[model samples]
Target chain A: MSGTVLTRTALGAVGVALGLYGAWLTLSRQTTAQIVSTVQYLVGGVVLNDVLIAAAALVVGVLVTRGLPAVVRAPVVVGAVVLGSTTLLAVPVLLSYGRKPDNLTLLDRDFVGGWWVFAGVVVACVAVAVVVRVRRGAGGSEPA
Target chain B: MTSTLPTQLPGPTPEHFTSRLRSPAVAARVGLWLGLSFGVCFLTGLLSHYAQNTSQPIPFPTSPSWGYRVTQGLHVITGTAAVPLLLVKLWTVYPRLFERPPSLRVRQLLVTGLERVSILALVASSIFMLVSGLTNTASWYVWHFGFRAAHYGVAWVAIGSLLVHIAVKLPVIREALLGDVDDTHSHDRATAVDQGVMSRRALLRTTWLASGTAVVLTAGATVPWLRTVSVFGIRSGDGPQGIPVNRTARAAGLGDDELGDSWRLTVTNGDQSVSLSRADLAGMTQRTETLPIACVEGWSANGDWTGVRMSDVLALVGADPESDVTVSSIQQNGPYYTVNTLQKNFTGDDRTLLALRLNGKELDPDHGYPCRLIAPNRPGVLQTKWLGSIEVQA
Candidate 1:
């Protein structure tokens, strides 16, 4: 009742949002095929990458719904927090990258479409995180 | 984690596998490709709006003979593939209508409601556009009610709808893309929870997985070597020119040199002082190019075009290379007019070859003949057949 936020759920949802935003920031600026290739290598496999993200996100969600952990959950959660947070800041730049091309004839909308998907994911995750953060505070930040 | 929430919601059963719900499946994934292909067409058209590349009195050539062909190819193939995709996607998403749809209370009402309405309109009109386009390409319409005008009109509807959909479904899209929202996936839910059973999370998860598969199939449909392993066997030989279409050439009332041996491409300047006949143009230098004519409407056919490049002819007449120009066709029955800039055309692109022949033969009257500028990679509207005169104006 303290807030419209998800209480413990806030910490967890925010974690997922951060991860999404991190991925978005990493991808939005890339024009050439290099980013896709890099992610393909970094994640090792596409399906594998999804699984990792899903597992991590779900674990964080569960952790947020539970009690707050400081020592273990803090550092990794902090890393994810940083990733998501950085994505938030990088969004405007990514947007401008797309918007600038709108007036120019040389740019393709496929690039814009690609950017939208990446950026949209980040923003969505942010919404979920904020909702949870306001409700319960940063209690269960760990899903490990 | 929640005391009130049940721990044993029934997981999505095997019945919910992709095949059981591929109707929308085909639409969404193929829609992405087809949609992007349309995007290419739309974008290329938009680019030409600023560049005025084709309208020039003289234009620089981009030199990749196949430059326009690739873009055109994507347009057609995406369109061809969409024929089946729209059918399937419509089927997949249709189930949403039967059940009492969920509420839109969570999101802002006006913005969200308008968006949802627009998306529905877009999806519907896109289907209309694609179907009408197919019919038009195949020449299936009976009464003929200004197909191009209607097509363009629907395009705005589709585009507008697309933007709204993007805005409204913004949340679900993120979670699907990010693969992280909540553990409310139908796969993960316990059997006891019934209230939240129709969770979007599960449908989206399925959609994403299915989307990946469809893209793979669509990509493989084009890849040559991959065709050897194609289990679905989706790819086709397309039309005679390796594009998609069924042209009844003989039925179209086309006859070889039907206009007779007296074929002349006359270039008349606005001043009317300088005019050149086909003979005069040929005397300077005649360039012949056998290039495939690709259109944004998603059809392609090859023909041999022989005549002086518009640039060369313009040069013979002392025309400026960089000025805007208009090429008009003698075929006045249809909307056979396009205005373009010189730089985009004759800039040594070699794409702007004037055609004198078709398939190692003389031009068929129905096809552009005597000489037509077979500018590659441009929409069907730009390739001016029966090219009459080149008028140079400021």
Candidate 2:
């Protein structure tokens, strides 16, 4: 084998070993029921992201991009992505899912307002970019 | 069996993914940062796990005072940053899901199979770690198993699979990265065309912005200066003594009688033993130290703790200078973290204190009441609030 192949093979071997050890740790440390639950979450997360989240995102992208003026499309797409992801990250806190009645300090932020403000900022920035692109004239599709 | 089966399935193909932005050039660039973020998170996570282990092969350091703060802050910040990076990466490479193997040969099929398996592991573990970590920081316990153990285990799986992935895609990654971001060339599907919606550079910029925003919104729990804008931060640095309380006295089930005037902090080393009441402890030599109580969940706050040095307490009992001590809480029936080891380095450190006051005032009932252990370079969970007794390890 060439040097590259030799390096790849060595790396692959180490990766396999580490992966197995990790799996073993998960299996041995947790009880049977815990392991089953963990696997469900682990596999479930992938399914949720790929099948549901990614599909929905793609569908939205196609729908939103259709019939939009070229100058505004990029900003809208970028805005949508940033807004969606920030919202997703803020969801747990927004819902106050873990908020304790006694402990006012935990999850005490005004997350809804924060998210809205964030959304506003994103929208404003996207608007500015769109306006700038429009003013710069059409066919401003050059790579950055 | 293979001969009878159809060669193709009725679904989207590589050509179906026609967005010009979804090219290897974009994927490779985003993947570089994503990989770096994961690497930082993994190393820092290892440091955190090692720091919290019950048995220490090597004693955790007690200097810098802000070591754990920086590492854990990085751990959470980098993990949060990975969210957008991972999403963009998946979007860039989603077309590959529809691509077919080069040939039907046994070796080719095996290689493709291995590659797919590694990808599955990487994606699943990455998503799981990020989601679980986010929920954990929010104190949202939706699962039954211990969060730390599962997170740690899956982290190994994630990093391992990630390494394998890099090794398998080395050539493609090198080619994509070495070229310009817009140089799609052979990497893009034939159907991909410039719709002028978004450039590859624009997408990369958006990904970085989203990651930075996520960090800014949540990192206030760790970075004090950004607290105001970090409106989504789990802890708002609001508590009894200008610091956030992880486990309240009420939550820990500590009643008035437990923390009453009659409360005594007992220190014992083998046959030697000494007990001091609240007033008695107050009468002893008091030292004040400003230290940050950093939590594993990534929020931290600095406090001015005034009390007797742990070294002084240990000396009162004539404990061995090199001995480690187990600090127990009054909440004997409480859940995990009720007991934690104070290694010799921490015990011997003059800055480590069994604090009786916070910000020059008496300890709040919720903030460990009469006394709590305040040590530098340690997890807040190990601080052992509502102190009951300390036993010198043999």
Candidate 3:
């Protein structure tokens, strides 16, 4: 076998083995409800990544790159990711998980307003980028 | 031109999405960020695990209360930063998932199968770790299994799979890094166009900027100075005495009405027992020390904790000041209530306090009302609050 293949196989085997053991330890100790919840969340994590997050990035990436001039494309994509990630992080806070009758100080922010303002900044930056790119005729050719 | 035409018999056809920008160079670049982020988080996570482990052969130190603060903060920061990097990394490599494996000798086929399985494991475990980790830091328990145990277990899986992945992709990563990023391979460039969109280099720059922005937006939970600007931070600078409260009195089912003047902190030394009320404990020489309560959730605040030292209290029961003592909470039951044990290092520290006051005011009910343990460099969860009793164990 090739060196790469040999190394891949050996390391892969050990990694997979250790991973399986950990999963077993975690699963065996959990109650049925916990196990089910664990499975659900694990699968949910995959779906959140492959389906929701990746799809959003690809779609928005394609849209900005395909529609905008080259100069604006990079800035807009960066803005989009900045907006997307910050929003994703801010969701739980926006949903107000920190707010409870028992605890007033946990979240204690106008997260909805904070997000809207943040979104506003991202959008404003993107808008300025589009204008600058258009004014400069930055694509160097007719945009495909 | 004829050679460029597709020439393979296909079964269960893979999805074909054409994009010239999704090249190995871009994937490797994003993978570098993903790997670094995960590496930092994993190492710091190990430190956090050791800090919380009650069975430490040597007791954890009770000084520089901000020690766990920095490590755990960096832990969450890098983990949070990885979210965007992971999404982008996966997106860059998504097309590879569809590429059919070339048929080969039986031995080669077996190796390929192992490689594919390892990749699958890596991807699945990484997703699980990032998602569950985020929820945990948010104090959201959407999963029923123990968060620490499961999170810790899956972390090993993620790190192990990461090693396998790096080993498998080392050559490709090396070549990608050595060559100019724009030097796309022939197959990838077949559909390439100079359409004036963002170049691969531009895309990488954007990914980096986005990650930096994410860190800036959320790191206020750790960097006290950044709290006002970090809109995404979980704990705003608004708790009593500017300290963030993880669990409240009401959340723990201990209300003002529940905690009456009749409450007493019972201390037992083998055959001997003593119960002291609030005034009795308060009247004792109140030593004041400033300590930070750093939680596993990645938020910490330093407060001037005023109360009696653990050693002085242990002295009351004629127990060795260096001995470990089990500290119990008044809350009926939960994972963190009655099982915490203060090690010799903690119990021996004159600064370690059964704090009766915070920032000079009488203890707020939410901040463990009557009393709470504030030790140096300990995870806040193990700093048992709502004092009930202490037992010196042999």
Best by TM-score: 2
TM per candidate? 0.50, 0.97, 0.91
A best-first ranking of the candidates according to their TM-score comes to 2, 3, 1
lDDT of 2 by residue, A35-122 (tens): 8878988999888878887898888787767868666777788888888887887777888889887788788788898888888898
What shift in Å separates residue A130 of candidate 2 from its native position after superposition? 2.3
Per-residue alpha-carbon lDDT of candidate 1 for residues B240-280, written as tens digits (9 for 90 to 100) = 32333222223323344534455455554555445555555
Off by over 4 Å in 3: A1-14, A65-71, A140-144, B1-15, B104-108, B186-196
lDDT string for model 3 (B292-373, tens) is: 8887887777889999988888899898888888898989875653578788888887788999999989988888879888
User: lDDT per residue, candidate 2, B1-394, as tens digits?
Assistant: 5533324657777887888888888899999999999999999999999999889888899988999999999999999989888988998788888777766778978888888999999998899899889999999998876688899998999999988998888888988998888885767778888554767777889899889988998999999899999978998888887988878888888788889987898999999999899888899899999999899999999999999989888889888655788889999688677888889988888899989999999999888878999999998888989999999988
- Roughly what TM-score does model 2 have, to 2 decimal places? 0.97
Q: How high is the CA lDDT of each candidate model? A: 0.44, 0.86, 0.78
Worst 10 residues of 2 chain B by lDDT: B1-10
lDDT of 1: 0.44
The ten-residue window of minimal lDDT in model 1 chain B covers: B189-198
